[model samples]
Target chain A: MIDIHNLDIDMGRARVVSNLTARFETGRLHAIIGPNGAGKTSLLKAVCGLLPSATGAIRLDGHDLTALSLRERARLMAYLPQERAIAWDLKAIEVVALGCADLSGEDSLKHAQQQLEVMGLSDKAETSVFSLSGGQRARVLLARLLATEAKIYCLDEPLTALDPAWQRRVLEVFKSRAAQGRTIIVSLHDIGLAAQFADDLWVLDHGRLVANGEPEAALSDEVLRQVFNITGTFAEGRNLRIDPQALPEHGA
Target chain B: MRVKSLSLAGGLLISGLVLMGALLIVGDVPLSGADYIEAITHPQSLNGEIVWGIRLPRNLCAWGVGAMLGVAGAVMQGLLRNPLAEPGILGVSSGAGLGASVAIVLGVGLVPFAVEASALLVSLMMSAVLMAFVARFPDRQALILLGVGISSLCGALMALVFNLSPSPVTTTEILGWLMGSVENRSWQDAALCVAGLAVAVGLVPRLRAGLRLLTLGEETAQSMGVNIRHVTLIGVITASVLAGLSVAVAGIIGFVGLAAPHFVRALGLRDPYGVIWPSGLAGGVMVLMADGLIRVMPASGDIRLGVLTSLIGAPLFALIAYKSAKSWA
Candidate 1:
């Protein structure tokens, strides 16, 4: 379990994540959803120790996160950033093996191969990442994330550039990992998919946590109207449908 | 991939050995196989004196400087995550050159190896400035721009040194040093290169894993337990030392570091770890061949090794830039 209390993240003079307190339980897939510039990515970055400006207490499994060494933190949590442009022409398997960097070379390669197979990239394992399509590269990156075998996985927009089928498959992989008692925290833009696949939802608006609970309770009508500025109909056994609407004036 | 990388490495090693052998025999005073044996056995003989006193040290210096630059280039490219990054891009070479010029013009030879000592000090100072910039910005583009800025500043300072040169002889000496050569280099120069190469070899293991992780970009590499600051510090220091030592021994040789990694990459070793040592070998071969060519050429004035390397390296650099731009497009 991860516990965040009174967290504040700042970029330059602007605060990106305000006094946010939340508990992320293990064995659950928690999805953070928000519109652009709503601190979704900032919150995720803070949790992963990527944000040095983040202040307040973050405890992972009852230990202070800030006190832990970077290697120890990495061993506990793996992060996949949204930007996926690899700088070199590393082979797919080689890129994935970086996730298991602590392992012996042969062992890391073996684990990386397994993860690549998990992502349905077995055939592309030896292919240079530059030659792969964007979607394939995304999968390759996802495989790298999975290869970490960390207790907590923080993925920012893992589904970007992926096809619908692959997106579902990726979610299923995360769901399975969550089932095995690992905590999965993902910042996603796809509200409908978050509702379908996530066990819990955290909604943010203007650097503040607006709502947190099960998707049905957290993504309330007020959240849709106030945060997203969209009216949405969400019912059990039906697809979520949202309509874009103009923001209502407070006086009117 | 392993097979291909190994084969490429083997090819480069064998080619470097052949080039070295050819270079030993094909100098201005051509020596037969018997003469080589005699030169090795009879050190008091005239041929032995020529071979031992001049040719060996010069060739060794060339090989050492080339290898150092090549490895330094590979490390710079990997650390910056830029295909075009090299020691020169970071102004380390120019800073060393400026230092040497200062030492020469000011007649600051109060101590042994004063020029070399000054060059190393300045290059290291440049690297320290770069490290501070990296810590402040942590952005690759910004780091690259800062490097360009430093390079320009060093270039201007070097020009000032030339303008204020006390005598024509002093100016000529500075000019000759800037053009870069291993000509008249002694065993000390060769030893300096060997020391730099040894340091590079020691750094390779420490550098390999981090560089491989860096290909994923800094943030992701950090997420995977890489210490970005540590890696950057080691990389900059190692590269600066190698480039600095090369300049101290052979003046301001350019493009060998930039071109060597590319040649290794072209031979199917794309990963930073696989590229480094072979890149060094390729660089040694390249300089040996260039030196041999200069010796065999019929030019009126001596064609400096630095000029020949740039002549070959600049075109390759352009081709690489074009390819990178095309890929971006």
Candidate 2:
């Protein structure tokens, strides 16, 4: 669904994302994973066309992403940044409705409302998003992305501040959406969640793409040791277990 | 909700007509309701030229200018994402005031519209330059500091112009404009203000989406498909023009711009369309009512619009700000 080629995002003098090439096919959940300072978020932003590529091309469904207008891109793909603090006192449902702000009519409103309910936010429909707990607010925003009818959902750390049960629920929602032929690319901090939910993974370190493939291959001990400077085993049992083989990623 | 809309529309129309009528009926030789009607029908039958020709046009001009100031103030607060923002804060008004002051001292009274337009244009350019400067900084404090610096610079230049003028009449006239009055405006001035107001009203709806996103701060707005630079420019230009036209007509009316929109917002006028129109209406009503008070009450020299507004608007503003602070947080 998306192709990123030789992407290098330069912020000031430093390159946030080094030359990177990747394809995100339709109908699967792909996770971008790495330690702190990784260019995972930058890669997601570049792919979603939020940032101007310092030196590369991002294509969505064979269309040059940079050439597409905002409305066109917004219609085909949805983006949820890591931070979701709203300044206005908009209702949870109204916040979701903003995803389809360009569109007006009963059908769009109904669809948005349904998406809010799917995120288990129907009871909080009229509640101000600011009044809701952090996890609930994230769910409200997720519903907004779901309401877009966009082919791809680019989420940068959708799991932050979510409780463990809510985290599982959100990951399941992404899995189900991918099963229904939507592309989900998420920047995740939780390695276990990435392995549990992602059909494919891209591991980044120091602005460079270190590994990309099946979750098992990308999260392998060798790649973990090299990219994260820590050795860990990915044990496939009881909902994707993680064996903490390293005392610490760095010297204690 | 529909009731609120209807009541709002009804209130605006009623208040506009009543205030216009009151303006017509009051003067040194007060006209009765019948006399006021006759004066409109038969212009030559007026008691004094100042009553029909001067006072009427001036009243209309004041009404229009007041509305424009209020709308500009509301939009600036929204655009800058700060409740305390006003046209005066960004030096747009001061810049425009300087341009008008230059024209006044240089004797360009014939095409008041042209003068107003030039003022608006200059102010808009200054705001654009300031916005460009502001873009270099990540912090809001930087933008405010830059604006304050520009305002002070303009204020100094304005003071110099008043000081250097050959006659006291120039200084007096500039002070009158700065104090803001609806005393003796001509029909041509009324036409100018109306034209400016029409342009602003037409522009507001097209920029509503961008304005909505802007409240989220620039980065967030950009993430939501808003082109920040274009929207900010549109808002700044539109606001500058409105405020410039207001200053050109009325001198330096204060507090209407600062207090009127916020008053309406504190009354739960959050939607852009309602905020624009009601703020305008509130501006008109507030200025006219204050003008009426200045005319009728107390044995005194001409009480300036600016003084009365800061007197009334400042307290009302403080109250509203206190109430809304927690909501914004």
Candidate 3:
């Protein structure tokens, strides 16, 4: 479980995440959804200790996050950033092996190959990442994240640039990981997907956490209308779909 | 992969030694086979003195300086994630040149190793400024721009020193040093180069893992628990020391650092961690071959080592740029 209390993140003088308090339970897939400039990425970055200006308490299980060393933090949680530019012609297997840094050389490669197999990239293991398509590169990065085997996974916009089938496949992978008792927090832009796959949802507006609960209740009509400036019809089960509509004149 | 890289390095080192041996017999006074054998056996003979005191130290100095620059260049490129990044591009060589110029123009020889000490001190200061800028910005383009700015400033200061030189002799000496040469180098200069190479070799273990992780970019490396700042600091300092010592001993040898790693990459060692040793060896071989070309050339005046390296390296650099442009296009 991860706990964040009164967390505030500042970039320069502007507050990107202000007074945000939330608790993410183990064995759950939590999705954060917000409009543009809604602080979804900032909140995720702060939780992963990437933002040095973040203030307030962040605890994992019972230990304070700030008290852990970087390696220790990394061993407990893995992060996949939105930017996907790799610097060299590194082989896909080598890129995945980087996440298994604590393992022995042969074992790291073995585990990396296994993860690649899981992502259906076993054939591309020896291929350079520079030559992979945008979607394939995203899958390679996701394989790198999975190879970490961390207790908590923080992925920012993992579905971007992925096809619809691959997006659903990735969400299913996260769901299975959550079933195995890992805490998975993913920030997503697709409202229908978030409502369908997420166990719980956290909605942000500007810099505040406006709603937090099950996806059906957290993404309430008023919350959608005010925060997302869109209308959505919510229902039970897996039949929830957000219909596209014209925006109001004055906005939310 | 590791075996391939090691074998490549060993091959290059042996090739360099063979070239050095062949060039040992081609100086101004031609040596017969018997004379070469006698020169090797008798240290006090005239031929012995020419071989040991003159040619050997000069060849060793070239090899050592080239190796240092090559390793430094590999580290700089890996750290900056730029194929074109090298010590010269980072203003380290120019900074060292400015230091050497100051010592020469002001005649600050009261202290031993004054020129080397000044060169190292100034280059380290340049690295510090660079590290500070990176901390604030953490952008590759900004870092390159700052390096160019620093290089321009150092170039202006060097020119000012040249204009204010005490005498024509001083001006000539500074100009000769800036042009880069291994002529008349002594055993002490060779030993200094060896020491600098040793320091760079010692830094490999510390830099290897971080550099490999950095292939995924800085943010990802940091997330993987690699301390990017610590790695960057060590890389910059190591490159500065190596480049500074090379400049202090052999003036401003250009392009060895830039070309050696590219050559290694072309040889199929794409891992940045595995590229360092082979790059150094490739650099030594390159310098030895260039020096041999200088010896065999039928020109009236000696061809400057820096001039030859630039002539070779600039074209390779342009080809790399053109390829990158085409890929982007």
Candidate 4:
């Protein structure tokens, strides 16, 4: 379990995440949803130790995260940033294999290949990552993240550029990884996907954790209307789906 | 795959050696195949003096300096993640040049060894300053612009020293060194290059993983257990030291460092690890060939090594820039 206590993230003079307190349990997918500029990325960055917090503590499995070395933290949790432009023409497999930078073993390549296959990129393993489409590249990067085999994952918009089919496949991959008792905290833009795949959803607005609970309870029509100011219907059935109707007129 | 890359490295090394041999045998003083053998066997002969004292040292110096520039260029490009990054274009050469000019003007390099040592020190300091400046502006275009500005500033400083010097002869002497040449350089220069090269090559294995991870960008590399700031500092220092060695030995031979790695990549090997050795070999070949051409070329005045390298390297640089621009478009 990962516990964040009163986390406040500041970017220069501006406060991005303020007094954010949350706990992420293992073997469950926790989704962070917020509108644009809602400090979703900043919060995720702080959780991954990419951003420093002046007035909070992050504990990973009872150990203080800030006290750990960068290498130690990196080995414990893998992070994937939102911007995904790879600067080199490395092969897809090579990109994935680099996730094993801290690992020194003979089976690293095999593990990387397995992860590539998990992302349905086995065929393009030898192809240069630049040659792949944006969606394919996204999958390849996902494979890189998967190759880490870390205890926790902090992903920011990992679903970008993925098609609907690949989106489901990626969520399935995350679900399976979570099933192995790994903690996952992901910031997502798609409410429907979050509602469908995530075990719990945390609504963030202006850097505060507005609501946190099971998706069915947290993503109610009233909360959705209050936070996003949109009319939406939520139903828990055989085929889970959330359809947002319209943005109400101002002050209506 | 590893084997194939190693073979390519081997081929490059063999080709570099052949070019060096060709340069050694065919110079202003023509020697037959038998005379070449005789020079090697008997060091006391007249032919031996020409071969050992002049050709061997000059060619070795060329090889060492060329390799240094090439390796340094590859490291810079990988570290900066900018194809246009090279020691020459990024003001590292000019920085070393300015440092050398300072040493000469101040009479600090009254001894030849002191010249190289001063140049290396100043070059490292300049690189650290440049890196610090670059960190302020993270954008690519801003970095390039800063390099240009810094390079011009170094050039202006060098010119200022020349203008202020009391002796016209010193100005004339420094001017020739500024143009850069491997001519009349002795084994001591070659030895100095080897020392610098040892420093450079020693830092390579430490940087290899970081270089690969760095190609993915700073954030990702850091996530993958790379200390981005630390690696970049060491990388810049190493590249600066290599460029300093080249400058100390041959003045300011431009573009070999910039063009060599690009040349190697264009030929097929794209891995940063694969690029390092072959790039060094390509650099050595380029300098050897340039030096050889100048030796044979019939010119009214002295042919400067810097001019020849720039003549070839500038066009290559232009080509790379044009291609990169087109790709971006």
Index of the highest-lDDT prediction? 1
Please provide, for model 4 over B201-232, each residue's C-alpha lDDT reduced to its tens digit, 9 standing for 90 to 100: 78887887888877667777777778776776
lDDT of 2 by residue, A142-236 (tens): 88878777889889899888899989899999899999999999999888788878899899988998898988778776776666666666565
Candidates' lDDT values, in order?
0.87, 0.76, 0.86, 0.82
Worst 10-residue lDDT window, candidate 4 chain B: B134-143
Provide DockQ values for all models, in the order shown. Answer: 0.78, 0.35, 0.71, 0.62
What's candidate 4's DockQ score?
Answer: 0.62
Give the CA lDDT, 0 to 100, for residue A44 in model 2.
Answer: 79
Give the residue spans of candidate 3 off by over 4 A: A246-252, B107-118, B124-146
Docking quality tier of model 4: medium
Sum up the clashes in candidate 2. 3
Clashing residue pairs, backbone N/CA/C < 3 A, model 4:
none
Q: Please report how far candidate 1 places residue B182 from its true position, in Å.
A: 1.0
Give the per-residue lDDT digits (tens) of candidate 2, residues B174-252. Answer: 7766776667677877886898788787777767777765544455456577776666666666677787777766767
Task: Assess every candidate by TM-score.
Answer: 0.95, 0.89, 0.95, 0.93
Model 1, global lDDT: 0.87
Q: Write the per-residue lDDT of candidate 1 for residues B168-222, one digit (tens) a residue.
A: 9998888887888987788888999999988888887797778888888788888
CA displacement after TM-score superposition, residue A7 of candidate 4 (Å): 0.5
